[model samples]
Target chain A: MIKVENLRKEFPLGRTLQKELATKEKIAVAVDNISFQCQPGRIFSLLGPNGAGKTTTMRMLSTIFKPTSGNIEIAGINAVTNSRDARRKIGFLTGSTGLYARLTPNELIKYFADLYEVSDADFKIRKEKLFDLLDMNDFQNKRIGKLSTGMKQKVSICRTMIHDPEVIVFDEPTSGLDVITAENIISLIRDCKNDGKTVIFSSHIMSEVDLLCDDMAIVHKGKLLYNGTMENFRSNQQESSLTAEFIRIIHESNAATV
Target chain B: MILKIFLKELKDTLRDKRTLIMMVVIPVLVFPIVLNLFVTVSSSFEKDAAMQRVKIGFVGDAQSPVIAGFLEMPAAMGKKDLIPYPNEKALLQDVKNDSLQMGIIVPDNYQEKMDSMEAVTCEVYYDATDLGIKDRAKSYMEYVEKSARDKRYKSMNLDETKFQVILTNYNNTASDKEMIGKLAGGILPYIFIAFGFIGCMYPAIDLFTGEKERGTIETLLTTPVSRLQILIGKMCVVALSGLLAATCALVGLYLSIEVFNLVDNEEILSIVRGILTPSFIIMLFLLLFPLTVFFAGVMIPIAVYAKSFKEAQSIITPLNIVMVLPAMIGLLPGIELNYMTACIPVINVVLATKELIAGTLEPVLLLLSFGIMVTLAMIAVFVSYRHFGKETNIVM
Candidate 1:
């Protein structure tokens, strides 16, 4: 299980000495006071618009960045402080490839496997299964630099799941992928949740989030606007679609915050 | 776990033919091209008429035995083919205008100084700004002194050996080629150490900074491994690659010596074993590794701060210039090095290598140097870990 409490991140407007001496005219709060939890064997998504702090929140939970004021626990480990341990428990895949271009797909998988130090038997079996499941065997031998974007995406997904951590996070997994590839990723997400893993994803794609997320929180400008199941979210809004509901709630939330 | 990442880097870097070629092929071939060019240009320069010929405009009398003898003396020594002028002032004027390669203002009292054992200042005039003219002028002056000394000895009715010694003293032991090679060799140690260190610096920075630039640091950090372990594993691969390149450069230097017959003062094959010693190996291993770590520690934080590989490269390129220039200090004669140099990172390595090359390395200096380097490397590796752990805004 993963938990975040009062997670907040604010960016100072200037870094230069001259600029720093001048008072900041504007302050950007990437993530405002927000909280959520994902129980074991559940899939939760953070559905929000652009600049909604969904990615920033996920980044903090993944231990890539620290929150300005927050505490996060991934699999009972303090992700904010005991990040290395938390990292061991989480398999993170960002939508923009973490793929190293010069390595072959086979090499990329094994490298991650080594970094995580998966036992030989488990590594071999897991790699074989991922190759079979994702059909990576066709181009696994080719350098990732030569691989198509969709192929690289498959490799990225394989690395995320390589360690088979208790917690998994994918930030915008299928955002740039084509229709077929995107559907494949959706199915992969469903499979991960079915395998009794705590899976969390952040996406602006409403239909994918609406169809896949078991529980979700709608976030706008760093604040949690709503949190519940899709049925609960649907009932609260008169907007025709989730994206429309997202837009309507954001305007309403913005007006209230001001 | 760091071993796993290191092995992965090794296997990946090995397959990069372009970089392997850059690391291996270029350094190996560079020695031959440089050595051959030096030899060809030097030999051609020595034999060229411009090097030997001195055209002097003499305003003095040729019919008079004294002025005629002064001009004919160098013409006989096979050093200079003296071109005469009408008068002394005319010779000085011609030299001033650069018409004469060398100018001799024969004294108006030329005949008087020889009778009095008083030394006649020849008033050898040539533009000191032009090096070739200055050297030729000095050579011509020596020839005049020899001629005058010979005349004095003959008048005293003494034999060639006794008169030559009493009248004029020249270092008969002087070997010009050996002198030139000594000069060249002084510069060689600097290039060898500098290029060797530079050769080490690139891959060290590449393995550490380049790895961070490639976004592998985050992935590697997530593993349950110590930062020291990661540093050691990666450093092992870099050190081996650097040492391989250094060896390739050394071998290339030897082969160039043999192939081009560069520095004909001694046989390269005969002295090769004496030159490459246990001291050389110890100095490089002890010296190069710590220097590598210093750079590795120094570079990684810079690499960590950058958002991309290109930015990291821009930060590290100036370092190449810095390393190369100090290694070049070996070219300057008798740059004294002591323990104080060991405290300075780049200078110590070059001095250490020069000591090893000259075969005078002390065990104490070696230990002191190696200890400083390794200690610094550990500190650098520790700092890199902090760099990774802190500063959230900077990307891997």
Candidate 2:
């Protein structure tokens, strides 16, 4: 299970020439007072558009960064205090992120496996299983630079799941993927949910969220506009599609004139 | 676990072509080309200056002994044997004709200075702007002065055998050849260490920051590993890359030194062998160890801070400037590598390597030098960890 309470992140915007010439430092708040939870054996989508606290929230959970004000627990371990243990319990995948261009897919995945200290025999078995399941045979030996986008994403996805963490965070997992590769990834997320794994996904594409998510949250400009079952979130807005609901909430937030 | 990460890093390093060039080939190739060019150009200048053809015709009567002796000097100089002339006007005509560099106008009173024990001036006329010919003329004139001084001393003592004995008895052991060679060797090691540092900088940054820039760091950090393990893993890769790049550069430098046939004249080979010592190599590697770590600590996470490849490029380009200029300071000719310098990181390694290669050092200085470097390396690693351990991890 993963839980984030009242998470807020304020990033200091580099003092512009105008600001520096004046008196005070300037900052832009990226994530603000967002709260959510992922129960065991369920898929949760922290749905948001670009710049919408989705990646930032995932980053906080991954320990790649820390949220400015928040409490987080991954499987009963406080993420702030015991980030390493929390890292062990979570798998993180960024959709647009690339693999090491110089390393072959086999070497790349195995590297993360070693970092996780997975037993050697198990590492080999799971690695072979990923290769076979993902059907990465043709390009497995090739450097990542030479791989097609879908092939690279397949390789990246395999690498993310290598450690078999309890909570898997997929931030924009299908952003640039082709229809086939994207479908494969969606099926993998469903498989994780079927296998009693906790999966948290972030995306703007409402259909993927509609198809795979049991629970979901709509975030706009760092605030949690809505959180509930995907069915409930869509029904509450009386919008047929997730995108329309997202646009409606954004327009409502924009209506609150500063 | 760290070893596995290290091995993976090693594999990654080997696979990158640009990295291979920065870490391997430049050091191996650059020093030799530069040094050999310096040596070739300098030696040629010296030879061309020394061997320039000249003729001197003495304008004096053949009956005069001093004038007859003056006519013999051009032959002794080897480039131009002197030709006797009938009068001063003819000698001047020969000089104007360009048939002679300058006519030696040794007068009848040429030997009178020694007889009276008074200083006599010998005038050499040559074009002021013709530096090479002027240099030769100056050297020949000084030779005449020294011989005159010797002849006066011999005349006062008036014993040929006693004069020879006194000359041999003077207790002096300075050999310009040996001294020059040692100095050359001492300075050469500084060049080698400079290449060592330069050769490693890009590769070290590439090892850490390159990985971060490529987005591999996000994956690495997501692993179920401790921060120490991550640091060790990353550090081992970068440190080893630095050490390896330095080794390639050293080999190239050693080869270049061998090709530098002129350095043999300095008698530095015996001391030059000191670079091969395990302790010297170990100390040098240790000195670089911290810098490599600091670079990785500074660059990798910093690289990750960039939102794009272009941004990372902007961040890295300035470091190259910040790095090479300072190292070239100790690398230039005549700079001394002293004990006090050993406290500075890159500069210290350059200096210590120089002292070791020259074998002109006190062992206490070596120990003290490397001791300071190691302590500092640890501190740098600590600072890196302190920054990496932050909740930001971006050094904000």
Candidate 3:
């Protein structure tokens, strides 16, 4: 399970940024005070528009960025204070996550496995199972730079799941992918959920969120507009559709601030 | 974990064609190609200069004692053909038109002056631009004058030694190795510094900035390893690349001397071989190791901070000049390793290497230079860590 309480992230404004934003504030808050929990064996969705801080929030959960203030617990380990140990329990993937193009899939997997300190017996069993399930046996030795988009995506999924961590963080994993390639990610998320892993993915696509998430949070401009289970969200929807409701919430928040 | 990262990075770096070219191909081939060209071109020039027969044009009577003396001069001073002219103007014209390589004007009463023991000045002219011609002319004239003086001395019937006074014998106290070291030792460290910086450059940029640009650093950061471990692992590869490049250059130089026979002087060759002893090489590496680390350290922060490979390159490439410029100072004469120079980073390494080659390095100064470089390298590593830890810098 992944737990976040009052998690916030702030980036200092450079002189250029200050001028561009026309603000004298020394810092720009990317993720404001917010709290949510992702239960194991269920999929939770963080929904936001561009610059909505979904990526920043995901980064903090993955221990890539330390929060300004708040607490992140990964599998009962305090992620902020014991980040390295917390990182061991988290599997983070993003649509923009880049693989080492120069390395073969086999080499890349082994490297990450080594980094996570997976035992030899476990690495061999996991590698075999992943390669077979993904149908990656034929091109595992080919350089990733030469792989097709689908092939590379399969390799990335295998890489992320190689350690089989309890918490999986996916930040817009299917953002730029074609439907055929995106299916691989959709299935991987399903597999992680079925394996009883705590999964949280951020996406702007309401259909994807509606299709996969058991619980959801809607955020806009760093603030959480809604946080509840899918059942509660569906029952409380005032708009004609999920997308319309999401748009309505954002518009209402903007109008209220203005 | 650091070892694993180091091995992976090394594998990745070796696979990069740009890093391979900078770290291996160029450094290995540069010395052999340059040395071969220098040797071939210089020897051809020497052969051409030696074989050409100079035409000597004279404006005095052909039977004059001075002309006879010139005719009798040895052939080894370089081959010559004497041509008689009616006057100095015709001789000058021929010399100017390249019909004659030189011109000599012996006075009409040259024999009378010689018989009377009066001073006689023979004017010899040659173009300064015509490389060896002027020296040949001076040598020919000096030979004829010396012979004429000997003849005059014989006629005087006095002891030749009586007029001589204050005979001087100058000697050098330094060894051939020391002389070569002081004069040319700057080149060794300069090569190491140049190649080391270039070698560190590509890997440093590719491993740090390239990782960020390619979007791979984020995944790496999410792994279980500490950031410091990753930094150090990547740093080891960068520093090794620099050392490898410098070593390739040294190997190239060795090939030029041993296999290519670029240097033919037996004495010089012996000195070079002696200077490359195991202890000397170890000492050279001792100076170079921290210097390469320092180079890697200096470049890593920029690489980590840059948003793209091009951005990192634009910043670090100019820094090469700033870093390597101090090594050039060692090429200058009289800039020995001292307290002040020992504290300066690149310059200290250069001068210390020079003194090492000359076998004159003080132990205290070597320690000081090493300590300073190591300290700077640590500071640079710390700066890189700080930049890398910044969320804004590491990710776009």
**Candidate number achieving the greatest DockQ relative to the actual structure:** 3
TM-score, prediction 1: 0.86
Candidate 2 on B1-396: residue-level lDDT in tens? 788877876787777787788778887887678777878888898787668767767765554443344444655464766678877787787677677786666665756754676665444555545557766776676665555556666768765466464444575464543354345544554444444445445555665556555666676777767767767776767666766776887777677667654345443554455455687677556656665555555555555455555565577667755654555566656666565666665566555655555455556766766677667667756765665565444322
Which residue pairs in candidate 2 collide? Answer: B181-B266
Least accurate 10 contiguous residues by lDDT in model 1 chain A: A12-21
Q: State model 3's lDDT.
A: 0.92
lDDT ranking from best candidate downward = 3, 1, 2
TM-score of each: 0.86, 0.82, 0.93
DockQ for candidate 3, please give it: 0.86
Regions of candidate 2 where Cα sits further than 4 Å from its true position: A13-27, B30-47, B55-70, B74-76, B81-122, B125-135, B143-182, B253-351, B358-360, B390-396
Q: TM-scores of the first chain across all predictions?
A: 0.92, 0.93, 0.99
Q: Give the lDDT of residue B232 in candidate 2.
A: 71
What is model 2's DockQ versus the real complex? 0.65
**Order of all candidates by TM-score, from best down to worst?**
3, 1, 2
**CA shift at A118, candidate 2, in angstroms?**
1.6
- Candidate 1, residue B317: Cα displacement in angstroms equals 2.0
lDDT of 3 by residue, B191-276 (tens): 98999999999999999999999999999999999889999999999999999999999999899899988889899899889888
Give DockQ per model, in order: 0.48, 0.65, 0.86
